[model samples]
Target: MSRNKGGRPPKNEGQKIKQAHLRLTEDQHKKLMQLEDQIGLNRTDLFIKRVLENQDFIITKDVLIQLAKVGAEMGKVGSNINQLAKHANTIIKNHQLPPEIVAQYNDLLGLHLVQERELYKVLRQMYRVMKN
Candidate 1:
């Protein structure tokens, strides 16, 4: 077998290295640390990756988590609406539904409408965040 070279791989022969000096405020530093933790990159690597890749810098983990939660809530609301629709259809087919069943269905439909409105608000908030 050939002898192994244990050190780091050689840099590209045509590449030139440059150094930058940056000063960060306390808040800036904290934000940087949060990004580093979320992205799983060190400060230098994160800076280099961002510069070289021209990546979009938006949507933190917290925002993503919130969006996920909103999606889950929307899904639950949709499932509930579907169930209500099925129940309403069954009542219509029977043509002899009790008053209490009709009232309960109307109440649940109102509640689902409120949930849908809230979901729309969340979706709008997400759109605004993405637009910026």
Candidate 2:
């Protein structure tokens, strides 16, 4: 025979355990594994955390890939601009460059600087999104 206890034992002890069964396709499983690795959580824990926190865990692989490609392209553009600037400097140092040509180079450099600033802003926004 057992004695009667209070209304509730404690927070965790008073709660009844519940089980949920999930079925995932092969691709879904693989994606979940990838997400687990990226988020540094196991499959069950990650799912539980997301559900309990009421958080949306939607992975936008396409957008991430596109952003990476754009970043690479921007890097290439920056590299090319750097090489062009070095060549121009060398030429200017070795031989006399016309004032008009120097002025044109300066304008091109300014344009590249503006482009770099814009790209940096976009990358920062993307980083913020990824961080959150």
Candidate 3:
């Protein structure tokens, strides 16, 4: 009988739950932002990858471009789902919908899965780079 309370899920007891806040100089912030935008990682993740995990690796522009494409495709998929839901609601006001709704849902789900696969491949490539 697991139930969510509608907020953030509880964290494990032993997890790394601490947070840090830092202020950097203008030049330092600029350099960090450049790496963040180019590598598709935020400051915390970049620090973890470089300092904590010690997985220093160079990421080319191609990887970032591929990630951007995956992200754009995901946005389009979400828009399509929202439009389908709106149309279905308009047609099924106080009535049962037909089976095509399930088909539409499945199609959207399949599209999202394909995009996830692409994202996974990019992550795998990054992992391979890290292992070297």
Q: Choose the strongest candidate by lDDT.
A: 3
The TM-scores of all predictions, comma-separated, are 0.49, 0.50, 0.40
lDDT of each: 0.77, 0.75, 0.79
Model 2 lDDT tens row, 43-75: 666766588655564345666687789878978
CA lDDT of 12 in candidate 2?
80
Q: Please give the RMSD of candidate 1 to the true structure.
A: 7.5
Residue-wise C-alpha lDDT for candidate 1, range 52-71, written one tens digit per residue: 65555544567678878978
lDDT of 3 by residue, 11-122 (tens): 9896868988879999999998988888777787788778877776767576668768977887887888789788888878978888787688878788878977887787
The alpha-carbon lDDT assigned to residue 123 of candidate 2 equals 72
Instruction: Return the candidate ranking by TM-score, descending.
Output: 2, 1, 3
| 76 Cα displacement, candidate 3 (Å) | 1.6
Q: Local error of candidate 3 at 92, Å?
A: 1.4
Report the number of clashing residue pairs per model.
0, 0, 0
Model 2 pairs whose backbones collide: none
Give lDDT: candidate 3, residue 49: 78
